[model samples]
Target: MIAIQNLTKQFGATTAVKNLSLAVNPGETFGLIGPDGAGKTTTLRVIATAMRPTTGQVTVAGIDVTHDPEAVKKTIGYMPQRFALYPDLSVLENLNFFADVFGSPRAQRTELIARLLGFARLGEFQTRLARNLSGGMQKKLALAATLMHRPRLLLLDEPTTGVDPVSRREFWDLLTQVHLDGVTIVISTPYLDEAERCQRVGLMYRGELIACDDPRQLRANLGAVVFEAHSTRALQARKLIEHRAGVRVASAHGDQLRLLLDCAERAAEIQTFFHANAISVDDWRQVQPRLEDAFVLMIAQEKQP
Candidate 1:
């Protein structure tokens, strides 16, 4: 489990994290979802005991991070955003190196290496140099290295960034298996779809924790009616609706335009507005809000004050 209270991290005059308080239960998969420079990485580093906070407190598995960082490190695994693998080292070599760093007993290293290689599906590529492997394989290798000591808590910062879609799904499947086995995970991700996979999510923005809740509850609390409008003139439709009364959000999504209205009764009026503007709509219908929708709304509201 991880606990943080009023945690603030500052670098010189720039405040990275501002009064953030959070808790993660045992065996739970918690996500820190945010955009670039939103303080997700800063908060993760503080919890991992890699960086000292300007104020507040952080604890991992009953050990205070600032007071006893060495003790906290033993109970947690921290994987940074960048690839940490040595290109010249083979997959097996990298694993062996990390095992040695963790001080795995010689008697257990063989079995542990075998199990981790098998778990990460790197058995076939054990002899392949890391530089020769694909991006996804390298990430898997880094994860295997992190698991060499079998820490109780895992801290991953944007682990899936730049990975192919298929590989991202495979990586999440592995994390799900790990979570099922009772290891607590705190992962920071920019992908809303990935955030939905977490048991609970903390939405961070502008160095502050704006919203935190289960994905479903967060979407439900949007308190708006969302509609997807498909049209050849999607851009024009967005412009027409962006400044309309009761319209909370109007943005183009691919070939379609999404609208979030403050009142469900305004749906008819939206249709009327399109007709009045001489815009031909291919289709339009109210739909359930998504995590991205809720996040955008939250950010917009936060900027109001």
Candidate 2:
């Protein structure tokens, strides 16, 4: 459904995306994940025909983004990170406006808007002004507006960033239905759990894609063992062993320290190190590698001199 080759985008001397190449299959949910400045948003903008590639090629649904951006825009729906709706407009008005902008058939506008209102759970809020809606509701409204045209490909840039957990789940539930209907989706997200939901994930760092694979396969192929060390002094424990031999990466999550080690045997060595440092290890055990672990490991490797 989407193809990019040797994609590079620059602003002044700073390259936002560098020599990136990737492909997304029709009907698949492809996730782009990384830290800020990783070029996730830039890539999405280029694919949506919102920005031209400095040097390279991007195609959406067989239409070249550079040569035929207008045609390419017809095949995709782009929901940016920020809410792009007019605050003064009511939910219904915003939907209708976007429908008009996209040139939705006048004959089908009423039915299309009605179905979308119900689909987005905004039927009851149709009369509510967009500025009055909660963060989650606003995101849903934006998504509804974007889908007014019935685009085949969905490009969402962190659609659920500030949304509450329940709302995030609700949004994903809606996306699940869209995926079931075979609409190709490419989303960029900071949440690893969200990435795990995708059919495949691409890890971007320093403006380049470092890894791409199914979530399960990415975790399985991390080439490391993860161990969680629970301690009241989690941060201290992390600092002590983060750069130690055999310990690849260490991050503190609340009262526990997530340790990525080169081998299972390193677990005993980590425990020994903790003991010697007087860092109480209340609980320690091996844990399954998660998508986040794989991402951290890959980015860490990329930072190696």
Candidate 3:
């Protein structure tokens, strides 16, 4: 439902996005992830028709953004990283205003608004002013306003960033519902956990796309052996194994540390280091790589200027 080819965006001497290209299938939630200043928003803005690309082309549902930006705007609902609703307006009033902007058919307003209110659990708060709502409720109101138009594609830029955990879950549920309703969605987020929920994720680094694939597939491609090591002196264990032969990476996960070791040459070395340190390595068997591990590994390998 969406196609981008060698898309590039720049400002002055710095490039915000560098020839980024990807596709989003209908009903799929494609996530773009990176740290701050990685150009996720710049890319999203291009797709949202809020900004023009420096080069290349973007076709959303067959409408060329460069040639038919207005058409692309009509077919895509864009929710920016910031709240876009009128704070003084009542929840229902905010939705009504956006519905008007989208020129939603009179016959469709009540039904669509009602369903979104239910999906966002804002039905009872319709009459309340948006400013009076809790942080989570306000976010829901913003999402409801964006959905009132029922655009075929959703370009959400970190819809759940500041939301509480419960609110985040609610937001994800709403996204799942939208996918079920056949809406193509592209979202940019910094949260790795959110990336795990996506059908496929593109990892961006320093304005360049480093990896793009299903989270599971990316992890599968790591092709490294993982083990959970727990010890009272966790820091000591980490230090001992970090530069030790056979260990490529180590990250602390709660009380346990995940170790990525070279199974062929250094598995024995890893075991020896752990045993000598008196750290209990339970579940010592090789385990699957994770998306976070894959991202960290990918970012660490980036060539520096």
Candidate 4:
């Protein structure tokens, strides 16, 4: 339930965000995908009413963020990229503190606190100090504290950054449960796999939104034939094809190299080209397009502009 139109934010001569327009529907999870310094956090802050945009309009839960900041804050929950919990506070104490800030009644605090702890999987660590928790647990604590008020809209900025794979999976599970409960979420993350989990993704770069669609839609729009190559020289293959004609893109994925060919070419053509050059490819095959491939293509185009 958020609408951002022509959003622009500037600091001195450098604009962190420019002419950005975004709409996040209620009951849906919209992801903001970008690298560091892409203005994802600045945009989030504008929507959260924590920072004012140089020029733009932001509305949360149908309330204008600038015109009714207090109302917007009251209806939305915010979990920043950086941890915002008191280092010395115990898990239970942190929740209680936020509940009080949200004016959660003393009678309702116990139940809400219990649910928050369980959802965050911090039930056993309720007595542990925040600073003593692991990276994942610290993020969960921040999320739990943000939810202490039961806000209708959840704004999470890289909720799983720096988390181990297992913890990241667990965090996504928690988010899905929260979404089922009718809370709309808007999240920004650098992880492409994480972007796949979103209902839709907004690809951002250089202070602008380049693309917005579901991961499937993004893949379909690429219109490029893809091939996967497995070889020890995958990086070398990537470098060889980086500027090669017929091959629009080449990137290394683990031990394999994923390549993109123009619509006029075929996988057989790519193999033939590499074979003629003595690239010594071990294995190659056509494969379905992935979000990572699409993101890479998008960023590459942005650089050209």
Alpha-carbon TM-score of each model against the true structure: 0.98, 0.97, 0.89, 0.95
Tens-digit lDDT string for candidate 1 (1-305):
88899999999899999999988999999999977999999998999899998999898988999899999988989999984788999999999999888899999999999999998999999999999999998988998898889999999999999999998998998898789889999999888899999999999998999999999999999988898878888898888778889999889867798888998888788888788879876677889899999999988888785
lDDT ranking of the models: 2, 1, 4, 3
- C-alpha RMSD (angstroms) for model 3: 2.5
Cα RMSD for candidate 2? 1.1
Assess the local accuracy of residue 207 in candidate 1 as a C-alpha lDDT between 0 and 100.
92
Whichever of 2 and 3 has more lDDT, that candidate is 2
Clash count for each candidate, listed in order shown: 0, 0, 0, 0
**What is candidate 1's TM-score against the reference?**
0.98
Pairs that collide, model 2:
none
Point out where model 2 deviates above 4 Å: none
Q: After superposition, how far is residue 239 of candidate 1 from its true place, in Å?
A: 1.5
On lDDT, the stronger of 1 and 2 is 2
lDDT for each residue of candidate 3 in 1-305, tens digit (9 for 90 to 100): 89999999999898999988888888888999988999999999999989999999999999999999988988988999996778889988988888888888999788988988898898999999888988888877777788776789999998888879988888888888888998988998877889999999999987889999998888888866777766566666787777665667877766677787767556667767678867766545556677878887777668433
Superposed by TM-score, candidate 3 places the C-alpha of residue 161 at a distance from the truth, in angstroms, of: 1.3
Greater-lDDT candidate between 3 and 4: 4
**Candidate 3 clash pair list:** none
Error of 1 at 93 (Å): 0.3
Predicted model with the maximum lDDT: 2
Writing each residue's lDDT as its tens digit, candidate 4 over 1-305 gives: 98899999999999999999989888999899987898899999999999998998988878888898999998999998885788899999888888888899999789989999989989999999999999988988888888888889999999898899998888888899989999999999888898999999998887999999998899998968788879777888788778877677888877898888886456676677778988877677778998988888888878874
